[model samples]
Target: MINIVYVESSLELVPSEIIRHPSVRRNAKRKGKPPEENLLDRSLHHWAMDRLDNSEKRGRPDIIHFLLLEALGSPLNKTGELRIWIHTVQDLCIYVNPEARLPRDYNRFKSLIEQLYVDGRSPPNGDTILLELRKININQLRDSLNPDFVIGLTSRGEPSSFETLSKSLCDFNNPMVCIGAFPHGPYQKETASIMNKQINVYPEPLEAWIVNSRLIYELEKCLNVYNSQKIL
Candidate 1:
């Protein structure tokens, strides 16, 4: 069984700092504007963009939806061994139930996230699978979860292959894969410091969902826990 942890996930509702994005730099160049004068200057100006106004354009963490689809397709969901967490930029980590059947409407999912950002806590929706929102850091996660191994996906790490990871991790009992959920700048240094190992599966970066789904799929295969054969 494996738990998926998304660090510095861009799962915020609105007013997320935008200056961290490469596009902001590109936009500045196109407009002949000087680089961000400083963090304070950028925060007051370019970083003030709201992601809620245009989620797709800002690259919100919509990957949560697809992560559910793929995990539920495997035996991992039913086994009660699958877990997920979204560690936001503000350290407001969202814990999601692997067994929770998500609403078919994507809007419901989006709304719940927005509400979390506003409320600073999980809503009291009856039987909402979004279990809890806690103020925690990477250290807390590692201490509480006590995973047998941890792997982080980042471009700065050594190039990785699924076959190599699966083989190397075969001896471990429980593993958690960390992928940054943001669409912009690289994950924070604090995140990299906590990982047991890091892997750069692609020559360049890939979307979070692509990296997540493929990694989980390959891990499921290696562990002999895929659901396909069980149905047959």
Candidate 2:
């Protein structure tokens, strides 16, 4: 199994900084609506009025939402061999089930994120993609997975050609890969200490979606995810 971790991700409650931004104010100013009401009128409005102070705003977790859409959707999840553990900057590690399908709908994903913010976990409705929630750090998470090999993807690491990625991971039965889900930030120190190797799949820095897609694609090929004739 090739498990992935998105560490120090920007999946936090909308900081007060952004909630009061001028752009958000302008949007809320329309019809003299409150910020939350304006942003969430058509949205799921999972955040209760009483709890808006503690509610999470969904900007950065959007990356993970897209990642889940790519990694855990449809026939890929049917393979039942992939796991994506998102370790947020707030120190909540969410394990997503490959067997459970995440909604492709943006509003649905936003609802899920809002719930994660309010409840510190997703409601277990069986179909929900969230598998587990743990109060742990990046180092502890890696140790918990205990994969035979650990690889960290970074823009500044040793260049790993795309052609060789599948072959590189194929040698290990259990390999855990990690990507920084934030736009641009320094990785936590523990992330470096926990990784067995660090590499950049692209010569230039790529967005999280591209990096994650390429890695998961190569991983699926290595696992023969869709090969009806081959057994995992």
Candidate 3:
């Protein structure tokens, strides 16, 4: 039920889209360096690592979100000029318990949507987007899908994640969203409990996707034949 996947930016994506991480910026400044430099820069990496080490030394939570990309020599590789796109999630992590070990190395714990994309724009000639939309419609036609709970991941509680997800909400009900390194103020207690179990504070990458797929499958089973006819 758990789906672990990897996602890489298409060649059309701009390289700068990845290097603008707050963790990278703040760390860059402490070392008397410019934050504009990419993490790939030897000087920048050393400076960022030093800053991270310093934070750990001071007992400040050093939560980081690692953006995974394809390694060099892969046949699908398309990056040219040694572009940097992995630092986009520099300082993003959830904290279910303040005293718990600050979740570091988030890169090692991310779930990718294989062959899926995050960019808003669809593929060339609008065919790819149309095809995807058709697939969703087709899936709905084949089964009943209604999710009972929904959990969301937002980098710094940004409204964009909600906005982007809302566009797809027609597929499910009002599910809960886990924002930032912390749960919402009202749902903190319940959210914390969920995080502790399946999520592992922020839902381990593998577990999170598995839960997502299960929810979808369950929703499908719950659909009524009458409702299905109406939607289709």
State model 1's lDDT. 0.64
Q: What range of 10 consecutive residues in model 3 has the weakest lDDT sum?
A: 2-11
- Residue 157 lDDT in candidate 3: 29
Backbone clashes, each candidate: 0, 1, 6
List lDDT for all candidates, in order: 0.64, 0.67, 0.26
Worst 10 residues of 1 by lDDT: 37-46
Task: Show where candidate 1 strays beyond 4 Å.
Answer: 16-59, 118-129, 227-232
Considering lDDT, where higher is better, how would the candidates rank from best to worst?
A: 2, 1, 3
Q: Write the per-residue lDDT of candidate 3 for residues 120-201, one digit (tens) a residue.
A: 2223244333111122221131122122443434222223322234333335443333322211122223223332112222
Candidates arranged by TM-score, highest first: 2, 1, 3
* TM-scores, all models, native as reference: 0.72, 0.76, 0.23
Candidate achieving the largest TM-score: 2
Flag the better candidate by lDDT, 1 or 2.
Answer: 2
Error of 3 at 192 (Å): 12
Model 2 stretches astray by more than 4 angstroms = 15-59, 74-76, 124-131, 229-232
> Could you tell me how far off, in angstroms, the CA of residue 186 lies in candidate 2 after the best superposition?
3.3
Candidates 1 and 3: which is better by TM-score? 1
Judging by lDDT, tell me the better candidate of 1 and 3. Answer: 1
Residues 140-183, model 1: lDDT tens digits: 88778898999888877789786677666666777877887766
